[model samples]
Target: MAEDRKAIVPVWTLATGDVRAPALAGGEPMTAERLAELRGVLAVMADVPIATLEAHPLPDKLDRSRGIPLDAASPLAQHLSQFITQSTRSSLTAARATAMGENLYRMVVPAKVAAQFDKGFICSMAAKGTVGGIRGPLVTSTGRIAAGATFVPVGKAAAAGAAGGAGATAGVAAAGSAALTVAAPLVLMAVAVGVSAHADNKRQQAIEHITELLEQLHEQKLEEEHSALDGCRDAIDKATAILLDQGKLGVSLGLDSAVHAINTALGAADRRLARWQTALDKLPDDKPVEIGTLTKSFPGVDEHGGTFRAHLELAALAIALKRRVVVLQAVDHAQSDPGNPFENFTRALRRDQQRLDELESGIAGVLVRLSALELARQDGLMPVFTAGEVDRLMRAAHRIRRLGDGVTVNGRTTDVAIEIARNKDGSVVVFPALPMGA
Candidate 1:
């Protein structure tokens, strides 16, 4: 996996009353004492090798004669044009004209340098601005900016075979086959008991009961299809052979067209089987019925009977019924609802919805904070830096070997040993060396 690279731009603020003079208690020039304090702060900044990018007012189309400075005397002023050009190249051209009245300036520093400046310089100056002490001429603040990417890995061609229309059709066909395989024998057993009748309510009840049982069996088989789809197909072929053998046996016993009855039952089972298979297919994999409950639901048979031929016929039918029922019961237990599937699904959906809502709210808050920061910059209460300028400075510092391996920022030590590499398949991976101590 390729680790996402986030562009981190360090931002600082300086309060200047030039743009919004009325916002100040009184519109005043730099006092002698205040100017001395500001000079001291600037002297400390000059010692630091960090490049500063100052935002300047540009002439609009109405005032085209007022051109920007071609060269700067100060080191901070020297980087202004370069920063603007870099920002424009990096698709931040709109930022140049977005804010008109700000006298804000930005500095691009390596994380290590920023950390040192904040701790060794800014804190000392801020501490001097106490109630009983002399107030510092400059008002300063600092922040950082970051972004991330998410990647989803794609599987191989073999995995792709389990998706798309062809896979779906094959799944339906297999389910139908499993349903009919288990259903055919059970239906025959019901018909052998002469439960298929017209007008007799008891016979109708028996037929309905058999149909329900077959449906339940079909569902179980379909669930097993996830793991034993091929096995179910094999079982279907064997069951078909057994049905044929039973029909021949029925003929020898003088039963009238038992083969025809078996075929008729298979046809009827196919019709209802498809519907049950479809229903089972829609069910999620996680919801499975209890095996114990399914086992208890299956009908058991006694071997006691009349004449040898009659007893054999009855026993054969009973055996077929029990076999199909056991298979069906297993299928049901493996696939059917262990608990309320719908309720579980609904609860999961609600939780996901709530999570999405929370994420949306969090993102909105970040955006609002960013907007407020921008407004502060425009009002000359904050300083701004382009991400490109920050990246360029970091790269240059890295080349010169001026930056350190670690630095303390806001009372926390942040290591710079994180390495990012890209794979041949285009995925990015990140490997961060552990810091000293556990």
Candidate 2:
């Protein structure tokens, strides 16, 4: 019999001032169309146990203690304390789940979309709270009902009953209205609490996401720094190797040997020039001297003696020219020579000097590149160079020039400079120059 009784369901409409249920079973004869509409409305209701006024216990009086001003000190403090209490009372697992959802949303959503979602969510919460406060519970029932019977708005139930051929009761409708008015504010309060919790969780998730991104960026920067450092070290090693190899060559055949050969040539030139000067002094000032006597075999004569013969001929012409060319030829012979003694020495000296210049230029180029790297680091264009790496590069550069030190090359110590000078007798002396600040 209970199942035979046509069930009356309620539908709560949000449209303004429309809170009535259709009649069912014995009201102004219900039409098939109206019944179908009523059924359609009920079809959307949540599938749950219908709560009746008699079956469910209602609070005797509203608890005003739960309403605002949690503390007597200050209104602000009271509000904050109530908020904190409510947040603490929320399910921790739910809050964590919500936080994870928010974090995921932030990671995937564009900033503009996320911001819009936040605004829309807040507006939705506000609307829900307002609607819950005004409309109360959407459904209520008043009769013996089966378990899991869905309920709808009181107005919808009455309208449905009327549509189903039932006469609507004014007393029941009034009671339902009163019950909804009382329940509305409480429902709205619950909604507000849930929304507030969601908002707080979203804010925390945003903070966590920002922190995660910052940490990732820091790690990336550290990796870049290490890469730049490795690059700098590799560059330094390559540059150092080049300088070391060049330095070995320099120590072997560079400044030291070139200077020694030049000095030796200068000494021989000085001796020949001295002999020519003596021969010129023996020639009569007014007579043409026989060139054969000057060409005759002389002690210490060699292939390199051509300069001496040229100087002698020049000196003889000087005797005829009244000693005018004496100092000219002597100075010219001292400065340079195209013969064996000085020519080979000049060529070797130039070659070594050019090599030294090239090596110095290469070293300078390496330093320029290094300096540019440092500048880039300083300007934040590249990763910073560590102090240890910089110091190591500097040390390597310093050692480059000294690569052949303590190592003999071609039976001679590579760390020597040749010195050339004239004695009081106009004879040239050549010796190794001492190292500076030795």
Candidate 3:
């Protein structure tokens, strides 16, 4: 049986992060729309600025500016701001899922392990025509095998026991339905580990998977693909009996490796995901904040480099805040997808959006402290922000001194406040919560 598996499964591996999902009939078709969406999602992850709204370029890119891109006169520009922001966030979420999926694919599920089950599954399907269950199918079969087997389109149950592969990629539902459909049905799921890059496991996924396979053979019904896998749990517990008794499972079956892969991959992915979070969800990092061991926020002066440290840090932060404002403004003007109820862009943004005043209040507070950096500027030292940026920051600074009344924070409030500025070194100054001083 183990030998049969080697030949049944393909020699696919995700170490390179390039995954060609198992071929569904139409040969894993990439429709123009899906391809475009994929490109836009990729661009968001790469930090590529959104360049155009014209369908000619394919997927709509996420613009950091969040404001107008080409001539504002174009009707689409006005209509597109909302679409851009919605797409921006959606693409980002998808990108994050993909990164995490790819990372785990590379670190956890070995090509051999995956091949073993797939191979076994293939052989079973060929001979008996089913898989009672497989590891990362981690997916609960959509429904039971009975005449009235029922399951929600989006299944919520995890397959019983047997939780092995930790870094395996899982799906978050299909890409909101693509115009092009693949032949064989497909499902994807993801899990985070120690660092949460979300290590969701109990009894290890292996334990969980094994448990499910056990159930399927007994009182449970197996998926069409799952039934042929090894065998029915005894007609009830047969597969489990075989797993331990007959030792039909391949080689070492390395249950321990799955846990290790989840841990290591999560740590690595945590760092990578942090970078993405800083640039996307939060303020962008123009540079890394490297003030000789100081936290992201430059703390108390440690004897030396007082004013000079303040000068550089403040300038960088000021530039970043200004850039943030520009993007926020774009988001403000952007519209929602009113036509497509399926996209749910409008409801999503409305549900998640912070009040405009509250959002701006964060910017406003940072603008005030950032003003001090302008005063610290030394002559001819190569200014941090550009001329155009300076003009915007300068104007924004005026509102702080005049119209900006002092902001007061209630000591008990836990509402999050964030302000970030970046230096050319790619280091950043991130200060969360209230504190305004120009």
Model 1 lDDT tens row, 224-267: 32122112323433432333222112223322233234233334
Q: Which stretches of candidate 2 lie over 4 Å from their true place?
A: 1-119, 122-182, 218-438
lDDT of 2 by residue, 267-304 (tens): 44345455544654565655433223433422211222
**Per-candidate TM-score against the hidden true structure:** 0.16, 0.18, 0.17
Q: Which candidate, 1 or 3, has the higher lDDT?
A: 1
Error of model 1, residue 297, in angstroms: 99
**Total clashes for model 3:** 64
For model 1, the run of ten residues with the poorest summed lDDT: 153-162
Candidate of highest TM-score: 2
Clashes of 1: 9
Consecutive 10-residue window with the lowest summed lDDT within model 3: 183-192
